[model samples]
Target: MTSNTSAAPRAARRRWATLLALFAILLIGAHLRFLSLITWDEPSSRLHPDERFFTDVASMLHVPASFDEYLDSARNPLNPRNYTKNNWYVYGLLPQTLTQYAAVMLSPQQVLPACVNRPEYSDPSITIGQPCQDTSLADYQRKIVNPDLAVPKLVWLQQALNAEGRDLTGYYEIFKVGRTWSALFDLGSLLLVFLIGLRLYGRRAGLLAALLYACAVLPIQLAHFFTVDAATGFFVLAAVYWAVRCAQNGGVISFGMLGLSIGAAMSCRVTLATLGLLGVLAVAVRLLRRDPLPNGQEDTTDRSHTAISSPRQVVTLSLLLAFAGGLALLSFRLLQPDAFRGTSFIDVLPDERFIENIQRISTFVSGEADSPPQQQWAGRTPFLFPLQNILLWGLGLPLGLAALAAWVVAGWQLIRRGNLAHLLPWAWVTFYFAWQGGQFVTTMRYYSSLYGLLCVLAAWGLVVLAAAKHLPATRVRVPSMVAGRGVAAKHLPATRVRVP
Candidate 1:
């Protein structure tokens, strides 16, 4: 009774400690990502080419005036493809769109638009007109110096100002906003990684994994830029987390949520559609193991009932998969509405614009484009170059080695025991590494989505290493007194520790 009473306080203390640890991890991640965000490349251009592209196009985007304008594929400002006359958009539209919208709603500016003076003047380039108002930052009760609210009007006015030949006026503020969003997304991934680890392994693994991710070089670097990599990586991890949940809890809601996550991931980057296969694999594993309960019933080898339930289980799995697929398609259409020319899911899947841009990018990367930038990979070996970069620069040597070791261990365990815990991460890391590492354009950002899984695996390896017992002494020497003369040496039994 005394022991039981004391255990409660101990558990409470542990929970508080875990929460405190998680909070510290988040603070560390936030600081790493957000510190010197806009001025990291102070002597050079702060924006990467991709960052420039996303923010440039985002600056041009505006809410459609009408429902018809929203549906118009040719003129929809939200569409990345329509942002340029050549229709040459390759990256996901959702991330930049969200950033720009958030910036419009959240960020403010002091410099008024040129159009404020010339009320009759309009920018022919943008269809959306700026609402001429004499609103100051003080109107919204925010500090005029901080420039916090009245953002939409300010952004529109900035667009108008740009139209008046002040090129990229007030863009630094927008870039800062974009960087803020990127940092937030990365911080979110850190939390998701912790949750995934907690769900899969336990609190120790979760905390360790979160710590590794928070301190990783690649994620921190990516979060500093206004590019879509950080947000895309977040969605990818979200899909994986939901997939694991669906596998554990078989129900309509779980499957639907998983589908939505996959769809959201796809909307971020179409390459992430591959994660849907992970979901399918999870559900298939559950079925093959013959878990009957909706909430993760343990597999049983009771052959007597197998014949009666096998067909039912198959049908149920099929229905769930079908429902999930439909929801995935639906969410994809809704989130990436501009990708579709019509209401059909067919338009989104066979997105010819995306395909063409991808081909063009491939041509550039493969050196077929004959562009000067193509020379970057002139002496680069596909697989080895990427691997070397990831080890030496991206993840750093120690963590990278740990993750690689974890991957090997996971693959071995999957082969030996078919553990889903091993299977899911191993399959993803293997496939992603093979695909991305084989590319001539294998940059570290391309593998950003894999960081979450790698960090988790690294933590797993570290935990395993910590928990391992040291080898026992093979023999021990003991002293014995013989008839008060001298101490005689004797052997004490000690078993040798063996590792299989």
Candidate 2:
């Protein structure tokens, strides 16, 4: 009877620990993303410029029925014909359209065409999305802001505000609603980081990794606005998780999940396909090798992962990957017809617009290529991004440098020692770092995806270094303790050393 009672309590304790860890991530990540999103006195969200475009477009989803009106309203409201014609249609359509439709669903069916006050009187562009002076803007308040009618005083104030044209209660509510979704997705990346770290490292390492990502300053900086990068980072992380799974244990379901992750990433931002390519590479390497290496899943941590042993598994996984990719392409074309122009999924890049984007990204990555003043890359040394920005700025130099050293050690161990298990992770960090470092201009936000994985590595390295000690009168120390100037190992060895 006592044992049974103790077992129940233990399970409850485990459940609570998991909940607390997840909630802590949510709190820290959400705060970073939504710093000052709402205030006790403010009526609208104080989001970034990208956020402003999303918020402003809530009024046009019904008036114009095209989500592409965002740029036109802000930059070319007077020239409605040339509004969406510029750069509006060039971005990832799903996120913006989702926000627009969600706003419309929450708002009234019939919203008045946003009136433009010409620049002769006032800059119409500045006052474009504001409530029109002639229309009874108050008439549609009921559909826009859902009132707490059970509270009489609140209902009365809400109704009174709708009467005034200056009261943009509907528009405010619409954007606020949209920002919630963005904030959640951005914060969701943090949640996944915690789980990934815990699975690879340990509980303490996971917590540290989650904190590193939450306060790292890059992800947080971009998380403030609902943008393609933020969404891409989340999907990329998802792909990383599935890739790790495929590496540790190649299975049919893992490939399918990877497909979904890659599809989602590409659908958000085409450039994110780079990570997907790495994922496919990871799968191929896993299949070809007789002794497939574990991808961080074999950590001393508690999770037990699968391994591939049968020929049937390989064939099934391959077919599922193709199925998932096709489904993703079909969905993207159906929803974003304008962007695809009836082109096949593979043909999205050949389109004139994508060619321009290719040139732009090329310019951004390679300093030799001429770029517009606004689109320049910082051209900083690649290593400094993680060492200086992530570890030094956030965690202080002592521990931060140790983390960087750890990453170097791992890479060396993989290359020289032939530690095949880390191939997937090494490829991810290497490709991403090469791309980011080579770029002529980069932002902290540009590093969010790579940053998440490095945080995991750094956290794992920190914890291992902190806990382990050399045995008395030992001739050899742990590789990291002596990994100066450079090197992962002499060869990728399978032997597990007991240094203690």
Number of the top-ranking candidate, with lDDT as the measure: 1
lDDT of 1 at 99: 67
State the TM-score for model 1. 0.77
Which 10-residue span in candidate 2 carries the lowest summed lDDT? 480-489
lDDT tens per residue, model 1, 71-106:
444445566665443357777767866765665454
Worst 10 residues of 1 by lDDT: 478-487
Estimated TM-score for each candidate = 0.77, 0.66
- Candidate 1: deviation at residue 399, Å? 0.7
Query: Quick one: best TM-score, which candidate?
Result: 1
Where does model 1 exceed 4 Å of error? 1-6, 83-86, 107-170, 290-309, 342-352, 365-368, 470-500
Clash-forming residue pairs, model 1:
none
